[model samples]
Target: MAAALGVLRRSDEGQSLSGAVLLAAHDLLYEQVPFPLGESSLCRLAELLVGRGVVPKSSDYEGRWYLWWPKSGRGPCRDCGKSRSLTRFSGRFGDDYRYLCARCRATERHVIAERVEQLHAMPGVQAAHSAWVCGPGPTGTRSAGGTEAEIPSAQEWSEYATRLHEMLSPLEWAGFELPEEWDTDFDRRHGGLLFETLWRGDGGVGVSYHPHEGKVVLGPFDDVAGQWPHSYSLLEDSLEIPVPGSGRQAAAAVEVAAGQAGLLDATHVYVAESAPEEARQEFTTHRIRRIFQPAAEFRRLPLNELLRETTEDHWLSSYLDWVVGRAGQDVAPDIVPDAAALGVAAWCWRNNTAVEAHHLETDVLMARVNIAVTRLTRQYICPVEGIDWDSIKDALMDPGWALPDTTPIHSLFGEGWTEVAATVCAELDRWRRLDHERLGAQTTLILMTIGGSTGYTDSWWGQGRWHSICRHILDEAIAAGLTLPAPYDRNGPEAFLADLHTPDRLSDAALDWIIDLRGAAFEGPRGLRMNRITRPPRHCWDPFWHSSTGV
Candidate 1:
């Protein structure tokens, strides 16, 4: 009964009785009965099947692993297609395993090293340390190659002078000429005035009065490399700072001013360090009072009013308001409002709608709409305006516009309208009229010469407007005496049919005539003649035959 069962279960390929019984047991235990078989037992069954040729052995190093027929031999090695080989390897014991050939590995390493060297030699990174230490001075002080100077404080210098029994050392100062273009009024009103006094060790620092805090705060001086990095540290440590007004009164005034400026949600206001301690304390207290207020109740504006205020040259606030308004319009519908979605939509509309070259997907959609509008206006609507839509249609349908069958020109443009399509079409038409005169020029020769693989697939060509325009131009050229031989044809015919067409089997004489005519057109007019080739004139249009056959 066991032998009969094995025979009944045996595969069509003639496997042994034991192997057939094992496979049946495997299928019954794992799949039929739904009893879970452990990995070790599964592997053992796989080995038995592989030994019986019911499955394939993938590798000898590992125990017999089953290979299904469909998935086997599908992968090809990068180096050679003959045998399956490792394409990637993990590192073992700190040494990297390589699956690539020795030559390819060496080439890859050389490329990586060159890129690394280029990065290390970049100028910005090389000057980082020197630029950091020098601050905003005209020149950096030279020190020993590997050593740096210690930064000194103002009190330390004064104390040292007093211990030496010397009068205070004369203040050594460096003067920088401010450009006339610098706004003096903005400087005075904001805090640019405080930065004018160049303290001995102080690099670049600016000051601004905080109206809300009624205090003067130290800000940073703007240089080519931007604000001084150490200004924050100085602000925290400075003593005997100037105080201007009351912080509570200033904060109230700022709130009123912000409301007028449409900044009702303003949260944090900065106070100047030079402001009076009383005013600073009051401003801090007022901020604490508003700590539990809902964020939606107020708008947050940066505390530096002088910087935030709009001038004719600076319209940041107005622009921000416009952006916010647009965002509000887009998010009025969805159940769950997403700020990021609104921002992305706004960005796409602004960037894609206004600029020509900036036309991305949104711009393409807009252009398609524009083209449809233009066509509709010309056809159904332009007649009311006394424009001739019929004439335009007739021009498009003219015999002069008909293209060749062999030239697959329509496959170049994408499906939708491209912004550059009209311009490209006009250029192609101009070239078609000029022909030899235009294409003889170096620039035109470069444009017309088709040498390298375009790498564009048929699907890509089928979808674009530019592809269709290209097809139209090529077809038009063929109709207007520009004969391009079919790309697939080896032995040229006067009219080469596509491969899918049934051959008509022309008479010997007619076939000879076609071949001769095509050969002459290619070799004589195009200057692609081969030596020791002779042909009789088959047609008047055949330039080579005209010279050779003299018919």
Candidate 2:
């Protein structure tokens, strides 16, 4: 009986056992094939197999009894056919061979399936998926960086002194010293601010408004090897100080950067004093706020958590809003939080969702392919494995579709899979295209390279009007030989090729304008896409993807 059940399990599509003497199971009993068992014996064996969970039972409505393996063990799912065994659950019928993968089982509920479909259909959802699958790459954000304000003239020295005085009280001026002759030269070391007073010796001091600390800082002249020894809290000066030479003091000095000053409180200052040999001084340190670093902020975006949600797009947008608000106002361009943090999160969420969608789509495509293969092979009495199903499946997943051995998969699986793979690939490509288009659409504050263009641009909006502005900005960034550091990178070249099928008159107009300006017409294919992008831009394009510079 177990032997018969094993044979039935290997059938894939399943086998039928009946009382009829001429049935296929009866032939095995006569030595016509293998497994010799009488007709009545086969029927009894089927009953025993069903009882032991070796084969799933068939409905009474069916003329013959159907036998299939138990669903509990690891193997391809009977429904979706996904070989990767994740959490499995039984179908409504029973806990037999008719089982589904977690996602497939979720579809048993019409509401859940509908919501999943709605989520897939949502604008920017597909884009997010593509971003996750590929990457958000190097989208820059507004961060706390050095300001490029015009160098203050000698006449402005008094005003600078007044601002500096606001940060320091007459009491803490004990060891603090100011230089007599203020250097008006723009120095990159002190946040591009001209020195109010220049210290002559090797241990010369400098001053700059700290963007992250929101206070004034006085540090060593050679910033690389030295420290900013002091940071002041202006709003409420219950004088917070750092122990003269502690690590925190050193950290405070380095964090002081040039940017628009923010409001500071008593908590912003830390002070400590080391006790001599006989006296052990208690180490008391005050922590006001974390010194902000864009790279550190990027690490904290919670991208993985966002990707786990069904509505990842909404969550990512909300998170970006929160980050922007937390960043606060009048932040110098250099010191603003990297605006690209939102895009990075969005990219991760989208990539994760896209992977899920890909697997789901693969199951559906493979099911159809399997059905066709089953019908054709059964008619021709051929081996199923002979059909190159793996090749077809791989092609469906590969974006490039450049299988090393391009020997037609159609020959092995028949022409049916060719259409199926093509259809699935086309659908997947749509999401990929959305992801590319959504890139520069997300944030305007940072310079980015939009679409398939080779140059970097400054335009924040995706509209045709803004594209021209972006093109000009790209030229400017290039002309200035600007290269960003760390979290920020120059908007380098991309594999973007504009979707020629875009329905927007503005997009078309913008293309036409480019052709006229450059005196070069784009005579390539219509509705053509290069690289990962697949379709035309949608009519209702959000210039900044869905992010606002509000925060």
Candidate 3:
């Protein structure tokens, strides 16, 4: 009871104790109790604690009890109206809590970049072709006076040419030709151009390009709009215009620059009825013929589909089909082959890490044990007398029999509560160790048959931008009441807590742990039925994360 209250009292958001909050609270009490205590059971324990006055409840108005933390005097931020606990920068932003959340700050930066793009596209600022790198801003390098540093080497054209070439190289795959005049102008003008990227405490991004010796210096619209002028003529002057896609093709973008350079075949250009006025006008200016095609048809074909279709007799596809069949569903498109691929890839990646063979074997077992516990607690609840032990053995060996439920246990058996709990506990522990042994003996070579660890690990999970994403995923799952199994070994607690504070480590380790848990848990006769399963999304293939060489 005191343990539960200690957790609740530690919350920065002490308004409501959710399942995640309860789990996090329970984790915070690791020193007092080491075993895995389920969140529902802990909630029940909290009820007992509050009613007995062992842990005083601050309020019961929100359908659940809440305890206020003395230091949790935080509320909505004054600027962004977001609930934040810590103040990022204090007096500079009036009040510290008045500052923006990480996301809002990030958006502000993107907006700044966008505003800069709009400013550069104006007629007066002559960069020829300037684009705002969308999404989040990089950590800006600042001068001693706190202003952003200038783009050094105005006399060095080679450096600028290399950078321009690097950025433009990826577009070559779209089957377009670059104008000789455009390339020449880019090379000649590279040295005399100043590329300035500015950043604000609220994460606002502002980028500008001007002649190295030119008088015009553009910045954030609000900061320099009065002195600066907007030129509508430049909108039509730029060669390459990148249009962000929408709907099913949200992560893809179409570069309309080639048409302006006379590289687009008029017969190949088609504008849909849904194409915006701007796109239509641009298409018209380029003398491109229009055919109405659905936006869905314009989407880039998925790389996975292309690869899978091209590779004849791919062992990976065959394995996926087998796994899907085992899951009680026919191997079909709706099952998301990518999810299975990612799960297998993550497993292989973890195997390559320095973790010893013994530990790896133990982790696999613990994962199975976790599944058993969840099944016993949630799926197979029944009294000792009512549960068919022989049926359980048969079910474990075969996939047909249903696990026992709580109703049968209570209705059929009135006594032996302690004995029932003990019996199941022993059985789960035994299976947990055996499953570990079973998995340790299996080959990890199947992972190599897929895209291997390269696509799954290096792209998303390995990237710094995706560092906090695992925490986001976990938080989402916990909020949705998805319970994970407890650690099977004594050392399991530390492994679970490893990298909890570091986002990258947390993400990598969390993915490894979750996959291991799912692989073992779902390995039962009823395969992969859990709704709240974690997997990488198609957006993970966003071009923003990639350069010419790839992420």
Across 1-551, the per-residue lDDT of candidate 1 in tens digits comes to 33323444454346545656766655554443322324444444544443443442234213222221221111233334322212222222122322433234334434543443354356764334221211111222222132343332333222221211110001110111111111122122221111132221223233332211123333333343424321111122221222212222223333333222211211112345444555445444433222212111222333233223322323323432343223221111111101111121122222222324434344223333222222322232110011222343334323343222221212222432243344333433443333233112211211111100011111111111222223333344344454444432444322333221111133323322222234344333221012111111110111111222223
lDDT of 3 by residue, 1-551 (tens): 46666655554344554445554454455335443434444454444332222322223223122322111123344446655431222111111212344345435434544444464457844232221122111221132223343444422333233222223222222211212111222232222343332221111112222222211122321323322211111111232222221111111212123212211111111234554555445434322111111111223334344334424535434533443223212111111112222322233212332222223234333333223322332222111111222334333333222222222321221244334334444443433332233211011111111222233232222222122333444444445444543441343433443443232223333435444334343433111122222222210001122233422
TM-score of each: 0.14, 0.17, 0.21
lDDT string, candidate 2, 1-551, tens digits: 44544555554344443333223343354344232334445554444333332333344213133322222233454556665332223222122324444345435433432433354357876343211111111231112232333333443443333323323322111112333223443433332232442221112334553211223344433333224222221221122222111122222322321111111100111122222222111111111012112222323444334224313556434533343223221111111111122122122222333332433233323222322322222221111111122333344444443212343324433434455455544433433333233311112212111111111111111212232233333343335453322122332422012221121212333333222322222542111112111111111111121123321
- On the 0 to 100 scale, the lDDT of residue 333 in model 1 is 13
Task: Judging by lDDT, tell me the better candidate of 2 and 3.
Answer: 3
On lDDT, the candidate that comes out on top is: 3
Off by over 4 Å in 1: 1-15, 18-22, 28-504, 509-519, 522-551
Count of backbone clashes, every candidate in sequence: 33, 33, 3
RMSD of each: 38.3, 30.4, 28.3
Question: Considering TM-score, where higher is better, how would the candidates rank from best to worst?
Answer: 3, 2, 1
TM-score of model number 3: 0.21
Query: Best by TM-score, which number?
Result: 3
lDDT for each of the candidates? 0.27, 0.28, 0.29
